[model samples]
Target: MKTTGNTILVTGGGSGIGLALAQRWHDAGNKVIVTGRNAEKLQAAIAGRPNMSAVSLDVTDADAIAAFAKDIVARFPNLNVLVNNAGIMNAEDVSAKRDLTQAEATVVTNILGPVRLIDALVDHLAVQADSAIVNVTSGLAFVPFPKAPTYSATKAAMHSYSVALRIQLEGKVEVIELAPPAVRTDLTPGQSTREGYMPLDDFADEVMTLFAVEPTPEEILVQNVMPLRTAEANGTVPQVLERLKAL
Candidate 1:
């Protein structure tokens, strides 16, 4: 979490929040390699971006992830930071019998994706100096968003896993959970232009400030997310849920 001079790998960096942060880190003097499911898009994202590259990675494919990990490790021997930012969000109505395809995919991409990637890279990271594993969860993890129930659940699971992983790698590696509010990104249709959500640049700027702290915080909670992040602890879950439902 030194904020600079580290080789960082960010998944789902083709667009949205992932790409935004990857660009910021690249600007901050780090060697950044971003990955996504789309090779063309990934290449386009890194076009003309010095010291920044892109690779294709289908997080839903376990075998692919394993192979990608090996190849990436071999290619970037100095890699010490892994950002598990790739995830999917979808809306579903659970009131009646419905196809669970979307829900299932969400679980695979958001939950198992990070687990598999971490499992593949944790050992390599442990031996490297200034190693860190950053998991991008959501504010919905603490307060569920009814519309994207499965997405919310997956993030919640990741938050819990990050906690345990931090304890296990206490001395060897840094485990950080980045819980974002409804930032103006295209995580969902029309979300990028949403009025009530935090601006993408604004969120990334605050995140960079937070990362610059001497002792990097374990949880990166932006101002907009504070209500949701602290809802349960503050006994404001009901209020937060109502507010999110209207979003």
Candidate 2:
């Protein structure tokens, strides 16, 4: 994918990794539109920025996604990049009976949200030059994080989905899966300042650098994430599991 000059739409871009990547793309000369459920947060994210805008969107709403797709295409006809970055993570106890609300919400927002959005915009993207779809999974997808089991499962599903989507869109649209490590972001309470997690700014900087590579990699795996990403293949799952347990 080209590093600049494309109109990009990033979901869940009001804060954290989404906002970071959107800002970097904007700085790189892309017209970036970020969407989030919080209108105020969205506005704040784009404040004092030109060629960067915001729209309110609830990815869990199928009807809203359909409408947003049509409207966005009409507004930015050259929009060719879609970043599926919005996700939620919740710690759940599997040892006892518990409310499934968080689990269900995770499934909808983390898995179905990207699937539906891709369905809505794939046709439009296919017709555009230099089109790309970036699916943000997680390092936990490769190695399940027991504390956020549902969140891990959803990302794992997305990883598989991205593989299939890439094959299906082979010639027309590029499908990239960006699997992040445990970055210090507020995806969960107190995670933003978590001791062991990678700093948000550091992760985002590495990500932007990776994006600048010619013939960009299909999977954007930062150094900090490599352990989790390769644990299974390297036969180090047990060691990785022990490390996660310590966390």
Candidate 3:
């Protein structure tokens, strides 16, 4: 949207992509509130920040989401932007006799959490002018990463959901999907310092530019994420799959 003067809530905003977005928006004069399960982490993220705050929220907990939504709505009555940025990624070997514990958890945090939060806030948003909902999916949503199968699947689900949500909320709220590539974030252990990942600041810089677009685009796709985002349409799925296999 306009990128400024809106009250925004971002889940999993303690670090990584969420942190970057929260800070950038806050800098642009928006009152930004970030949430995380870890209270300490949330505090640390906004330690020296003005116009930015944090709240403890375990997105996987339906009850917690409900309470947090009520509290947040009362606290920030002008809230108009909800960024569904909280997500988890883990490597799962489908070939093995797996318990699927992590996979189930991934579904809860990555998919259910955002859906629940949206359900809680949709009514509030519909009444606000120029409201927006930003769902953070991934480049992997377009091409599955063999190792993180469930994570990719969850993101794909969000991608599909965002499309429908946009049409359904056509006049009431703006629906946007931000499909991030392999950014330098610790979405998985060691991913922060890993090779072949985009630098966090660099990615954030590019993303902020996209967010400033007038008549905001439905999908914010950065340059690095374009290949996979367009892979299916260009008939490069096989080639992309092979490349992913190597990674």
Q: Pick by lDDT: which candidate is best?
A: 2
> Listing every candidate in turn, what is its Cα RMSD in Å to the true structure after a full C-alpha superposition?
0.7, 0.7, 0.8
Number of clashes in every candidate structure?
0, 0, 0
True-vs-predicted CA distance for residue 128, candidate 1, Å: 0.3
lDDT of 2 by residue, 42-121 (tens): 99999888999999999999999999999999999999999999999998998999899989999999999999999999
Give, for candidate 1, the lowest lDDT window spanning 10 residues.
Answer: 238-247
Q: Give model 3 RMSD, 1 decimal.
A: 0.8
Off by over 4 Å in 2: none
lDDT of each: 0.94, 0.95, 0.94
Task: Please list the residue runs of candidate 3 whose C-alpha ends up more than 4 Å from where it truly belongs after superposition.
Answer: none
Give the lowest summed-lDDT range of ten residues in model 3: 210-219
lDDT of 1 by residue, 178-200 (tens): 99999998889999998988999
User: Who is ahead in lDDT, 1 or 3?
Assistant: 1
TM-score of each: 0.98, 0.99, 0.98
Q: Mind giving the per-residue lDDT tens digits that candidate 3 earns over 1-247?
A: 7788999999999999999989989888999999998888889888888899999999999999999999999999999999999999998889968798899999999999999999999999999987999999999999999888999999999999999999999999999999999999988888898888999999999999998888777899999999999999999999999999998
Native-to-model Cα distance after best TM-score fit, residue 156 in candidate 1, in Å: 0.4
